[model samples]
Target: MSDHDPRPDASALPWSCEAEQSVLGALLVDNAAYDRAADLLRRQDFFDTRHGDIWDAISRLVLAMKPADVVTVFDALPEAKREEIGGLAYLGQLAACVPSAANLRRYAEIVRERAMQRALMQTADEALEVARGEGSFEEKSDRIGSLFATVRETGQRSKPLFVGDLMAQRVDHYNALAQGTVTPGISTGIPGLDEALGGGMWPGKVIVLAARPGVGKTSLAQQILLHGAEAGHTGLLLSQEMERTELVDRAVANLGSIGYSRLLNGKLSNPEWQRLGPAVDRLAALPFAIDDQAALTLHDIRTKAFAIKGLRLLAIDYVQLCAAPKGAPRNHTRNDVLTEISRGIKALAKDLGLTVLLLSQLNRDVEKRSSPEPTLADLRESGAIEQDADVIAFLWRVREYESHRLIACSLPKNRQAKPGAKLGLDFEGHYQRWRDSAEKVGHTGSVGGSADLGFN
Candidate 1:
């Protein structure tokens, strides 16, 4: 192709030199435009090397609370690099080229679009390489998914809202609350827990449900998922430790009020069998799904979660069982991996605007103590779980038969309500369910302490 040809050569990559120039010029002409452009455009978004350098210099000056005019930006550039960007004269020309700063956002967007196109081209090349390599199908799929996730994240870049714009949304929310039309969050189906949470589990929150082994952490998580589904919310249960059939069996036991041992051993009476039919039917009708993928990485969970339409809540059976991303830092200890996993789950909750309830195992320290009640410090593997969680609840049950059925659900950390709130729950081991204890039941009372078998 000729040098002046309108058609691009096959080897030529996507770029927008003019758009990059206009963006930098706009910032220089009206320094206020830097705030708007900075959100949409990064230095690397510029196609030309010189333009990239100029944008980088402008960014440093603007971020330092200094003016980013042509003179200031030029002066900020290193002496060795000034000559490489066509000297100070080119900087002046760039500022003069833009007619007005009114279209700064548009120019920045164009630059960003070109950058994304270039990134996609690079990603395609990498995918081709992966396809040609000798890797497992799952490995290739994960690599491709990671690439797409990166691009999706890049496209979600947005400017910060003005206080006035935020105030408008706040006013609307206030009106909804006043009119009693607002559904603040998804309910856990337990009135006491719901009340303690101010309403229920909110979107974009990470809730850690932890306890010593055999304390019903998984059961509680399943209960929340089932209840959320019954409340007209779609939910996903990612069981890294349990089989799909096992989870279904637990659901059946909870729904039918049958003994779990009897259900497992096929020792149910005819009446119990009859109860199971309707319970299974009810579960099938609800919008709940389960995945029993072993050693699942965070990316796998995120990909599977995104495929479920209208998913409002996601429950991971246990956090420690989850595998870290492939090729994670070799120097990272087990605790570091767990910390990364916690942060990843937290980020996923915020990104998808859904609630993530993570079941976790408590450290042995809780059991060694006289009380045997778990705390935020007792979360296994990493303390990062406590920091990342919006709410941290510990399920404490005395192992004796008499007290085994009583679970003291304590909230050690609650971002939405007062912390250290404790709820007395009657644990029906046979039914695999929990009910709020009666008002007369003390926090440390046994399951039989309450005459009420239903939640408030």
Candidate 2:
């Protein structure tokens, strides 16, 4: 390429003209090296467009099953391109300089490395220019993520696909499953419930747990987060509704089987006091964290997730409560705002390969219905969660006996398993937890319990 080309100065940007030349020469000397070079280097990886052009011409001839020596490659180029790159004589010079094809792959590696550096530099400059314009942190942060995403996405190139190669991988995967080298997914520690979930909360999946105000949805979500943490997986609870103290106390109650009230009011019974210390120590040791920021935007949650070193699971307390990001359209309704947030969160979960346990608030109609059962339609504020989530499990307080209410866990919409099955869990309000119950549906009592989240 001409020296006056608009690209940045060679010294300022990362690129190796000599390495690019060596790569071209290696291919011309030994056609067998072209296969390895094609796998590693794209035309854009060449610093000088002239070198890139020569590589492209050689690639076409090699793929066409024609010999790509200096002569045939020189004749392959158009007249204008030939004049632009110093003519057939320049190709001859390149072929004469390289002694052998021994260093072809190494030269290709240098070309690819320099190309990545240039891409990163371009991304930084674009991000800086966008930041100079007016925007909130959320907007600017999202813009920078998009810019880097462009660089991170690789262009697809045609290559060989062998089924024998794939079958070998599948056999290894099956062996791993059989040998317990990997559990099916993140297990819930609840036997029947885990069975209903087809093993557990899966990676790259969104599970929505929706309920009305008094149903202990937050407590249940907290239970799952702790379960994951106990299994050595890192987790985060990003709650917009609950305070950090309430979350921790709920965790303590679930772990210690202590009354949630006692933990809140510092009035523990004697036996409860005995169980508290070990539970506290265990909870302290688990790889779990909570963010109870009052007005957390979607952007804030994403930043927090990325910052955690090895985050595998995240629980957003109740979807309707997250703040609308700045610069939302002025005329958007609450549904519109929630729809946008739900869409954004689903994208975030997939982008990060997170196993998201998203708590949702059911519509007021859930309380008014005669059967008192929740459904996908009861998902409040946004239909987007129902559409985006991989699983939709509903929770409700069903009064089958006067002594206590049974928390019915219904899997009405599971993408990976058979849905429409229910699990009856005895809600231990004293400890703010749920344990599996096999209570028959017809058992009767003077059913009564307040829909009070304070129990959690």
Candidate 3:
């Protein structure tokens, strides 16, 4: 092939040179190394075999395009083969492999990278121009938004499927849904709660536990962490209110069967101390990690979640505390903030493919009058929580603020479960636990004392 002409197979390039050039040029202009280029190239199928080999040769040649380096590379090749192919055709190998569908992917990827870099550079330039008072805020935002839109829109649509044809596929993907196999493996932290939640939280489900504050929302969340850890699940508990030590104390008191006051006051009998020591050790050993940052943004949480391995269930202590992404500036009203919070939580649930249980505080309006019952409209701040949440649960204990009275845990709004079906639970102050009252009443109260949340 002539110096100006691309080889015959150039059209078959699996990857886009424009993309590679865009990314490489962008990175190079920023003085970034070519290691990522190697990575980008390796993701292609043909690159795994032939194109990868030829691409490396092309990269080496391009980097050392200087005449002296070219001479050295040529000299290294065998004399007879060198004479037969010559330097030009040796360089033409890249062009020859370019048209192959396999190589096309690498070329396209490289071109995309180059385009991105160019666009980014242009963006920086435009930003500089904006800083120089060349454009208004509206103009800059629109321009930046449009440029990103173009680049995002231009990205490769799909790669060839590795799984072959759909008709010939044999793997039973729906076995989990059909045979009821639980793959993600999450425990709801309460044995009874797990049973109620269809054998604990399934992957990629959003479980919104909405309740008025001081009604055992946080305690229930802690219970989930305990149950999950007990079941050998690695739990990441992101709490907004409590500090790490406070969480540890609560976990020990709630799940470890240690008295909260005793643990805090450092009071225990010798035998009790022996039991608590190993219990504390076991609690420490459980695959649990907690972040108690007071006001973390959703982006920050998403970043941290990405770092966690074997992550099963994600429990956000409360959703409202989370800040929105860098953009979408929070509006003046808490309603606006709630809108952002709901969107963030839902996005996180879908993105991470894990069950998310978000603790939500209810409006005090539900408590002002007699017969306190929560409505879906009572969800604080925004309706996005109700709209996006898969399941919404409210916590109501009869004796929390009242004397011995029967309180109903009602689900006025259930996305999946039957609406108006109340899950009856009894509250005990001494043990601080919520127990199922339905089975007990049917059994004629023969089960001794009723079950409680065992909260302190």
Candidate 4:
């Protein structure tokens, strides 16, 4: 028996065997045609199991900088596997099946589309089972809807994921972590914050950071973005509130420890000017992009994000400023509109496998209360913010802001680790920077200096 068995409705489901054959044929005929595939089609996308096997062999050879032709593929295949696929003559037939390799990409797309169709049909089958099972209409509806949501969130499960296999993978992950072979997530660059986040803001999680206006939310959020970028992770910042120049200024000030006002006013002294070179060079090396277009809808965000290859982190200035994909109804309240935006953002985070640092505004009620600090309730116009977010953090400060420059980061809700975790970062507004509370900033001979931030 073959390793991969065809499904029950294999014939009934949508698939173009010709497309699958053509992709393999192109690769076999012209070894250089593998670039046309460009990591687009996976082995699982192929309809025929033998074609998938051929694809795997071709991929391995091409990736090794070797040619993937008839003789090599035949030798790469095991004896039993080759017999199952009708021997060397079959590979020869596929090599000669295509006239040219010019249309390989289109053929790969068709194979992928058919695979997706089959996946959607499989998801529908699961939904049908939930429909027939005993449950209320609403419960069944939610269950059915989630079946499709899974398809969007992480393509298709492909097969039943047994816990035994999953547990083994977890063990490997844990072992790797302990052995320093892998990292849990991208670091926040703050040791205490990383500990609170169970390493860091993991992929596929929505982290909501809310604060009242003039409380340095944008500064703190952008500080984190700079840290992620400096750590060699590809990140995008969607700033609807601040201009791109102001954002770059903040980054420069934060990185160089130069006075923000002096930099902005073009009054940077000799020493400050000297430090600007390293800061600018550092910024230039980072793989970060900023889109400061006003009024970006969720669709616009998603579409623009696709243009950025290997994007892992996306930070929006404030959730309230973002528009929904289809726009809200006229009858919808402010909360309803915000709710739609929140849910869509959360879905986008999961769909794109991103760690979205979603900034929000704390409602006025937080100030009206005896305490000026915020809770989950202060998550601006939407209760959905709390519902959709994996981590809800606040910028809390009770004492004076300018003098002490202490900002408390309080996490009231954290799904990955202990909640009610608090960490303090000292804000140097003069420099538009945030540093560990233990660190200090002071002026040396003529230049400003700060504790080593360990950023390149």
Q: Where is the poorest 10-residue window by lDDT in model 2?
A: 440-449
Off by over 4 Å in 1: 1-12, 16-18, 21-31, 53-99, 134-165, 256-278, 329-331, 398-404, 439-456
Q: Which regions of candidate 2 are displaced past 4 Å? A: 1-8, 22-43, 55-79, 92-110, 130-142, 149-163, 294-298, 328-351, 381-383, 400-404, 440-456
- Worst ten in a row by lDDT for model 4: 439-448
For model 2, residues 1-456, the per-residue Cα lDDT tens digits are 224352557668988877888899899999988987888788788878888889999999999999999889988988789878778878888897789999998998899988888989988999999899888877887777667756765532446878887898888888998999987789876777788898788888889988877777887778888989999999999988888987888889889988887788889999999999999999999999999886667667777888888898999987888877666678988888778777777877877788988888888886665677776888887778888889998887666443345877888899878998788877777677766787743322224555554544
- lDDT for 153 in candidate 2 is 50
Local distance difference test values of all predictions, in order: 0.81, 0.81, 0.57, 0.78
What TM-score does each of the candidates earn? 0.81, 0.82, 0.62, 0.65
Candidate 1 weakest ten by summed lDDT: 447-456
Q: Candidate 4 lDDT, tens digit per residue, 1-456?
A: 223444565668798878888998898888888866755688888778888888988999999998888999988887888877767888888888999899998998798888887888889888999899987875676566556766664553244556987998899899999999888888888787888888988999999888877668888778888899888778999999989998899899989988887887889999999999999999989988998987766556666776789898999988888764332456877777778778877877776798999988887887677655577877767788899999998885533344336666788899979998877777677887766786321211111133322211
Give the root-mean-square deviation of each candidate in angstroms: 5.0, 4.1, 12.7, 14.4
The window of 10 residues in a row where model 3 has the poorest summed lDDT is 440-449
- Error of model 1, residue 60, in angstroms: 6.4
Name the candidate that leads on TM-score: 2
Pairs with backbone N, CA or C atoms under 3 Å apart (clashes), candidate 4? none
Model 1, residue 433: C-alpha shift (Å): 2.6
Number of the candidate with higher TM-score, 2 or 4: 2
Better of 1 and 4 by lDDT: 1
Pull out the clashing pairs in model 1. Answer: none
Candidate 2 to native Cα RMSD, angstroms: 4.1
